[model samples]
Target: MDPGLLYDLSMNDYLNFLCVSGYNQTLLKAFSGAHYRCPDIINIMDFNYPTMTIPKLYGSVSLTRRVKNVGSPGTYRASLRVSAGLSISVKPNVLKFDKIGEEKSYKLTVEVTSPGDDEAFGGITWSDGKHYVRSPIVVGGVRGVFHVLDKTQFIDLGKLHQQLNLEVRRKRRSKALSQIAFVGVLCQGGTVDCMK
Candidate 1:
C-alpha cells in the first residue's frame, strides 16, 4: 500500500549519516556555511559536556542517501551547502522532452542553408565566420520524365459535347435561315416561284 514499495525504493534503499571531526571539519566547514553552530550539552555527572560527535553537538555532519536499480534508470543529484543543519535530498531526476523523441518526424526535417565564401578556404579570416559554412554543397536538381497519355485512351466528354452541340446548333440555324430566305424569295417572285 505504500508508495515507496511501489517504486521498489524499500528494496535497495540506503541511508547513511556520517560524522567526522578534526581534519574532516575543515573540509565540512564550507558545507555548514553560516548555519548550524554545534549545540552545547550539559551532563549531571561532573557537568560532562556532549562532544561534537553527539546529537546535540556543535559543527556539521553530512548525510548521504543513495538509491539505485540495476535494471532501471536511477536519479542522482546533489546540491552542496544548502542551509546549516539542513541537507538537500534530490530524487527522481527528470529527462527533458528534447532528450526523448516526442516531436513529430516531419518537424525535424526543416532547416535553413547559409552561404560560404571561397576566400575563407585560402586562409582568409572572415568576420562572423562562425555562422558561415560550405553552403551544404547542393549536388543536383530534381529531374523527372513525364509521359503523355494517348488521346484515343479516353472519350473526353467536354470536347465531344462541345463539338456535337456546335454542329447541331449550326445545322438548325442554317436550316431555319434557308427556309426563311426561300419563303422571302418565292413571295417576291410571285406564285410561279413555287414551281422552282
Candidate 2:
C-alpha cells in the first residue's frame, strides 16, 4: 500500500463519508453504526431481519420490531404493506414521541394464505405525510413453476432463452423436432432439477 494514496479523515468527516456510502456492505461493517447519519429522524434499530427465507411456508408467521424515535418532538404513522398470497398486520401503528429516544415494540402478524407461493414482497413504513421512511422485505420458498428467475441486468438468461426460441422458430423446424432446446440443455446441465 502507498502511504500517499491513503487519506485520513476526522470523526466528523468520516461520518459524512458514511452518509454517502453507508449502504455499501463493506463500509457498513467498517464504520460500525452508520445509522447515526440522520439523528433528527426516526430510527429503526437492529434491523437484522431485512430478508427472510422459509423452506416451506405454511399458514402464518409472527414477527416483532422494536423501533425508537431518536428525534425530539416527533409524531409519525407506521404501517405494513404486503404483496399477494400474503398479508401483515401491525399493532399500535401510530407513534407519538414527546421526548428523545422514545422506544416502542410493534407486533407484526404475517399470514401466508397459500403455501405454494414461490415468493412475495412487503415493507414497513414510518411516515409523517411529508417524508416516507421504508424498509424493504423479500420472502422466498421453492423455485420454478416457470423456467427462469425474473431477468436481471448482470445475467439475462430469461431474455436470451426467449431470443433463441424466436431464432429457432425462424429456422422452421418440423413438429417432430425439439422445442426450447435451451431449457432441456439447462435441465440436463444439472443446475436446476427438471423433475420439479
> What's the lDDT for all of these models?
0.23, 0.52
Q: Itemize residue pairs with steric clashes in candidate 2.
A: none
The residue-by-residue lDDT of candidate 1 on 1-196, one tens digit each, is: 2111011122112110112133244444455442333323312111111111112211211222222222223222222222222222222222112222131110001111221211111111101212111111111111122122233322243345457667767777654433221111222223433333
Q: Tell me how candidate 2 scores on lDDT.
A: 0.52
Top model number, TM-score: 2
Q: By lDDT, who's the top model here?
A: 2
Which 10-residue window in model 1 sums to the lowest lDDT? 118-127
Record all residue pairs in model 1 with backbone atoms less than 3 Å apart, i.e. clashing: 38-58, 39-57, 39-58
In terms of lDDT, model 1 sits at 0.23
Tens digits of per-residue lDDT for model 2, 1-196: 2111111233544444455544554565466644444333322322324333333334555555555555545666877777777777777787676765566666666666554436777887876665465656566742222233322421455457567667767887764342443321233323444333
**What lDDT does candidate 1 reach at residue 63?**
24
